[model samples]
Target: MAQNHEIANEVLEAVGGRDNIASFAHCATRLRIMVNDKEKIDQNRVENIDKVKGAFFNSGQYQIIFGTGTVNQIYEEMEKMGLDGSSKEEVKSQAKQQGSGFQRAIRTFGDVFVPIIPVLVATGLFMGMRGLLTQPEILALFGMTKETISPNFLLYTQVLTDTAFAFLPALVAWSAFRVFGGSPVLGIILGLMLVNPALPNAYSVADGSAQALRFFDFIPVVGYQGSVIPAFVVGLLGAKLERFLRKRIPEALDLILTPFLTLLIMITLGLFAIGPIFHSLEEVVLNATTAVLNLPYGIAGIVIGGLHQIVVVTGVHHIFNLLEIQLLERTGANPFNAIITCAMAAQAAACLAVGLKTKDKKLKALALPSSFSAFLGITEPAIFGVNLRYMKPFVMGLIGGAAGGFLASLFHLAGTGMAITVLPGTLLYLNSQLPMYILCNGVAIAVGFVLTWVFGFSDKMLNEMKISGK
Candidate 1:
């Protein structure tokens, strides 16, 4: 660790001291740096530094890829040197050069989603466990009677489980604000407005009679209680708007007026414009998804299962959360939920395969825990630490994910609620689509396990490819 730290500091100095850095951030495995002049930085020198795995520039940011644990320490050192930005110029420039249409769309989605993954996984697992404990049958199986599951315990568990989803906008707001160099508090306040219980609700009339006027009109400012997209959009707008206001507002009144006016305008626009547009788009996507799933279960499962890892990696997996919640509210079961479950099973299979096949003792140890975690619906450890490091495991995971997805779709298995654990969550699909869900899940896990065993451990496999040539 000391050697790693010294290497990181040397690399930072090589790139150009604190003043040369425009902004700095890190993902799971890379230290992302924005420099005032990329040409002035010595990329080769930085890359050659000890413990520096690799370095590259993309999306207008200089990125130094390092071990996951090392990246954060490096970023902290950068912050201490005052490299963090106070302006939006770097982000704006990156956004503009990101290209147009689908390319830009995917990048934007990834930018918004990746930062909040840790929180999502933690909360998701808590919810999944809560579901297991709450089930009377499951409790009895554990030798704990219904009396053991107290109301207070259930209530607290529900709160812990649902906190992430319920305050999703706030999370989005905080993340976006950080990215944009704005006050997260302001963004959180704006996000809360869209979901606030004190705010007015929308109503409908069935018989062509006049509907009573609710507090706010039904102009598509739907509740953003558990939303992801709206807060992100609003945060982007707020950041740019706040910066603009700071320069324009007079120095005397800038402190109070800047935030006040910024919040008002951002919230208004979020509700009236951005919120409605995305809401409609979401509805369309949901409807299209339902239609696709309703057609043929096997095909749907295959596509969803295969794309599950990709979706999660890109961070758009939350779109499924919205679809699931919407379906549950309307129909009590969600078709998309099964896709995620299968995705987890596939990841686990891939991890297990890599664990069994690896010659390196350390790699195998890493893979073993990752496999167990992925089976429990936590894929980050497997994705970043194990599968991602081995080419074969990643491909196998994708193939396995697709296989599982297809099976789930074919069986038409749907989940009653979101889950963090795949094994226990399968029970949630038992009531309406029990047979199909079981069959699909079983087939997916079996295929994943078999394929991983067959391909992952083979001597000729890509996982055997080693950087060190050991």
Candidate 2:
């Protein structure tokens, strides 16, 4: 408790005291601080503070890695010391002000998608569970086969596994509306219109089972069951239109007119204009992603797996959410999940190696738990706190990531989902893919451990840290 206060005081002193702090907030693992002047803070002094893992300037804020529970403790101490911290969202808003337009755009995409990840993850787990239950071998062990399974049980499984993607556009639209400062309920209605049963089913039209409704035999229209980009576009345009209408419409009539007009106009454009154009664009993006992922001999894997963490450092990795969701929508699986899992596992293993090899008790305490967090698919602590803190371990982790990714590609290992990886990722591979998924992560962890053990850590690094008080 006293250490938390001391750390807080040290941080305040390092950053040129309370008056220099413009605003501050803490996420799960870091203290994100905005300063009145970047030059006023001593970056080296802040990083060298005891229990502070690392520090970096990113996304318009000076972020100090404090690792999980300790960050909250330190944040509380800071709060007690007359530092009036902003809410994380408020801090994020200020940080967004500092970012370039492209960074802010990417961050918006992140905000829109993050709220929907848990639902998709649950649906993926359900899919994996269904696959396991229906497998002939697993069914045989239970004295049953696909033929012997009850129709009701099969229907139940479908309900669990198929619902999310079936109405994914609705989810996307709802989230986008919320993020874009519009009514989410209207977003839901608008999204439902896109997938309304009155339209020819999208999959059926694609498979030649049904023909799309056409006007003048030219503009064909179909339901957007699993589409992403169209729903997002509609949500954005709809929110903007709604806001525009709200300002112009009389207050007495606003309640009735705004939603009515907004929905009527957006739904028309959504079906006849935005839906067709963006859905085509979405297909192009999906095809391009597939082509890259299918690049001969794991080339895609090696490149993406090696450099993905580097992208994370820049805070733009959330853009992958779009590509990943598209892949799942089209293919019913996400190969990208396996490759990224290797990267995360390598990070964990490298951090673990550093922990095991280091004699410094403080370093060991930070590294080991950070490594465990990475194993569960959250890698920030392992990356910024431990691995990147020692440059060699990060490099070793990247190499290990590439190696494991190569195997993932060679074995054609993929997951039933995204957003979950490494140990929890095992749930996504619960069917026939379990062994290969395990193997990929095993190779990543092993290579990371071995390489870091042999070359990434040494007594000299510790000596340097001690000498520099870093």
Candidate 3:
């Protein structure tokens, strides 16, 4: 605890003290600070600070990477020092005030998706495990066949794996509601109503085994299971409707009547109108994404692979999680995972090239570990710390990623899961697919390394390679 405070003090000193801070906040790993004067920042000093994993300025925020729970502790110390910290939402508001519409949209998209990844990731791993357990090779090892496998075991795995997607709307709605300053529980209720048993599961309707419940002979009530857009829209509307109801309801009846009316209206509106319209629209989007990803002869791969890390730099990469999840839900495979891994591996390789080329011990220390981390499926350290600082490396990484993605698409490689990638990505392809996954990542890393070694470093970087003797 004392050590944390000491490290916090180092950060405060490095940033030129409290008066230099315009605002301060932290995300899952980065301590995102907006300062009044970028000129006052001791960039080299901050990067060397104890407990900081990496530091970089991006999106107008000087982000000091502390990694996970440590950032929260550092922020608390800052608060105690009378630095007067701002919440992440406040930081976001300030950013929106400064950014263009497109930037704001990207930020908002990240906000919605960040809180939802863990839910999806856990579900994805479970899905992979279910596939692993049911694989014919594994079954053969256990002296069983698919038909001979225990029905009870399949039911358990299926329930664990499928429930998240089946009830995905509720989870997304709850998260969206919380983000929008609404009652999350109520948002979940509305989502559940959209996917109510009475309305019939979407699959049943698709197979013509079930019909939508007709409301007043015209409006077809339906569930939004496995849907995203409708749940998100409904969450937003539910928040607005709740606030509206609160404004008009008498204080005496507010607690009871406001919630009741809000829930009642939102639930009905969600099922009778929003669910049908938005779910169809969502399908259109999913179909469009599939088409774009399926463009002939690895063309889609070239585009997605080349530009993917650019999106990551903007922190909007989480938006792809939805696409990946939806792809897996619909087709039982995710080719995007293979492409994304390639992109990450490229950056990892770029970091390696930078580490090997730099004479500065400080720079070398930062880059090598970052490269390793990126290989292990976390790329931020490599990206923000090294490759982005040398713009050529970032571009090199992108090109490598494009090459790898093209190969992956041409090979038609797919994964059993969505979230995990890079070196750790082998776990996702346990079904005789690990070799192909390795080949894809190898292409990415080798391309990135060769390109960066040849053309990534600037004359300025080489000139500045001398470290100040401590």
Ranking by TM-score: 2, 3, 1
What Cα-based lDDT does every candidate model obtain? 0.66, 0.89, 0.81
Candidate order (lDDT): 2, 3, 1
How many angstroms is residue 464 displaced in model 1 relative to the true structure, after the best TM-score fit?
Answer: 9.8
User: Across residues 281-368, which tens digit of lDDT does each residue of candidate 2 receive?
Assistant: 9999999999999988988889888888889988999899989888887788898999999999998999999999988887787788
Task: Return whichever of 1 and 3 wins on TM-score.
Answer: 3
Of the candidates numbered 1 and 2, which has the greater TM-score value?
2
- Name the lDDT of candidate 1: 0.66
Top candidate, metric lDDT? 2
TM-score of each: 0.64, 0.95, 0.90
Q: What shift in Å separates residue 7 of candidate 1 from its native position after superposition?
A: 9.1
Model 3 CA lDDT for position 83: 82
Clashing pairs in 3: none
TM-score of 2: 0.95
C-alpha-based local distance difference test score of model 3: 0.81
